[model samples]
Target: MRQHGLEAAISRRRFLALAGALGGAAALGGCGGDGGASSSKVTYWVPPNAELSRMQAYLADVKTGFQKAHSGTTLDNVVVPWEDALTKYTAAFSGGNPPDVTYQIIPWMNKWRSTGVLADFRTLDKGFTDTFLNGVNPDYVKAAEGPKGELLGLPYVGGYWVLALNEALWEKAGKPTLPKTYDDLIPFAQAMTFDKNGRKLGESGYDARNVETYGMCWAPSPPIQENYLWHYFWSFGSDYISADGMDVGFKDDAGRAALRHMKAMVDSGAVTPPNLYSDDVRWQAAVMSGKAAMAWSEGFTAEYAKQYPQLRIKVLEPPAGPGGQYIVGACGFLSVAAKARNRSGALDLVKYLVDDKPLQDFNKLILAKPVRQQPSNYYDGLDDPRMTTFMNEAAALSKYVKITRILPYQPQEYLVGKINDFLLGRQSMDAMIDEASKQIKQMAKAAK
Candidate 1:
């Protein structure tokens, strides 16, 4: 698994050094007056989007709106690549400054708090956190509470992972009934996996190498996918960490089974060998081109199937892992920096961005559906029946979705990263399990 930008493995020392350099360069660019503690200037950093030009235009528009609303304050917008955000942002701090407002994914969000860079963005508004308590999945609300009970940040935009399949292709293959439990998923996946000869694993002409399609590849894609696989670890009735978030849980029977199942997908020829950022694209392409029958994807899949309208896509509630049916979702947060010289401005912007009008508009700009209490922005894709189908299914499963509750760490480090090592033959599974357990216990101890 060659590093593809953020997911590529870099030693901790090297990663920190790189981030420090990036942060130093940005700080030298002037976080806008007095080293990012400016009284009248507020620095806002957002993760990079698919189209950077579109983001620039949107930020320009937002600048105008925010200035109009604030009268005298200035909002300086910064773009941080989403994938390596933690390191870069950490580097910014090392550079002697960080943005006043930053957008962060869930896993790293708490890591910030642990690092002392996180501000209680909710403290600015008395009822602000209340909005998130039940706005989306209630789990998000529950997850927002920090280990010490403080609200982490507002649950911004989010999506949940689910089981998706090409209905037409499935019917063509005899409409194999999907699994009801994790124990049953492997065979179903083996049936879906096929080679150049169009033979499933058990077929006479089946070939593992030179494959035409894969059964499951989600777990192999890292940095981008470790969190998704972490969801699987929980579903398999074992967590990556201990009850107090201080130790490894994978050495146990349940975790061992889940870890092995993930490895079996590769060993059994259910997925392609590790490739550099190829699995995600190839798996989707395979499904669309009738080479593969199923995939695990997020709710955003609404737009994916639309690209191949001739094909019919259907979704199933994720099969219950050893732990029972569970789903993992994530959110982008609008958080204020604790040491901001312009607290009032940062607070105002955070509140403004999450307001009904701003949130709805933000969602539209990103092609995401609005989850606000009231709708003011018209999301065109919301009208697509296919998107609606996906949304409805996601909404119905809200009861099972877990957001920020999972352990906040380099999910790649002790979890999927080590697992990848096992798959790559760089390490033995037993060694991976032992080392991951030891590292997790140390990390949890340090979190305290």
Candidate 2:
């Protein structure tokens, strides 16, 4: 809930990716339109990542933008601070004051759908969806469907995982670069790492026990572990759970590869040892201090720009593994409450918000990738070579990316629990997989 700025959300949200949750927005139904993103009177609520003073400006822009495009409409916008989002959204829903439209993260989306309070956008404007999500895959939209099979809304936000490299250290190490495939990550990290005595890991005098500058950085803290490792699990081909949600399906080569890769990073002295920084905050600090040459995580785009204004942060999609170049994340939406006061307007607005142009302002403010699935440069209007790479690589790699989701179990605890044991050396990847499989089975049985 970055109401004013980054310091709050950055420090408080352990994962930053999923820390702030959104839910509870809808309007009592009555109004009409051609199931488009238009309405004469539109009331909308969005997460307050925008600056407070600029709320009116944002609203004005939306009002102007919508009216200019549609030819006779007014937008009334509201910014709900992330911290107070849940409270306010809840009041809106339970107190019968849900807005005409509102956006939320995936978890709450399940909640909204189960309540049967959200409009089925698919049914509302079938033609618009085709136009809005022209190039996007149908699976992403299907995944966002409500618990009861209702197409709640189109998923509108996503936070992609990208690698942040230290240019100076990379050039110093003869510019060890991104791998053609993820399989080469360890070797690259090895080449980029340095022992405390200024010896590269493979050098004759290199000492693993006395490592100084590492090529990679990560923390085993639960949330951070889940955030950083989940994608690897996907890349390495671990489903984390069975399709039916009744099993943890990590008992295979893919699962082993995922854990082994993380271990190799640490063992090769390319990543900061768990002994040094036990949390991402500290691990990120290590990166800033030149203790690590690179880190792969979220908030890097915005945080680097803010915290290390002068440092040019190089970003690339994490290399493709055997399972390919998919990223792990959730996609939520800006749904029209079933009973929205201006259903047509809500539909139209949702359509607009998910497009490239309408998302420009929101995208400018947040570092995460936008939800629009079409090919759009990640940093199109921004100036910077690193951002240029960010755009090019993201555009080139998006097809390889997948946003995974499930409702039957809590992925954070379910997967992170086993990963923690594996990270701590208390269990083998196989052992962890076995344990997770058992736990998921039990949980599924209980859920039944």
Locate the minimum summed-lDDT window of 10 residues in model 2: 1-10
lDDT of 1 by residue, 61-88 (tens): 8888899999889889876654456677
lDDT score of model 2? Answer: 0.63
Error of 1 at 357 (Å): 3.7
lDDT of each: 0.61, 0.63
Candidate 2: stretches off by over 4 Å: 1-40, 54-56, 67-73, 137-139, 147-149, 285-289, 299-303, 372-378, 383-396
In model 2, what lDDT does residue 85 have?
62
Q: Given candidate 1, what's the lDDT at residue 213? A: 65
Off by over 4 Å in 1: 1-42, 71-74, 81-98, 106-111, 114-117, 136-147, 193-214, 260-286, 298-312, 367-399, 403-411, 417-432, 438-448
Query: Measured by C-alpha RMSD in angstroms, how accurate is candidate 1?
Result: 6.1
The positional error of residue 65 in candidate 1, measured at the CA in angstroms, is: 3.4
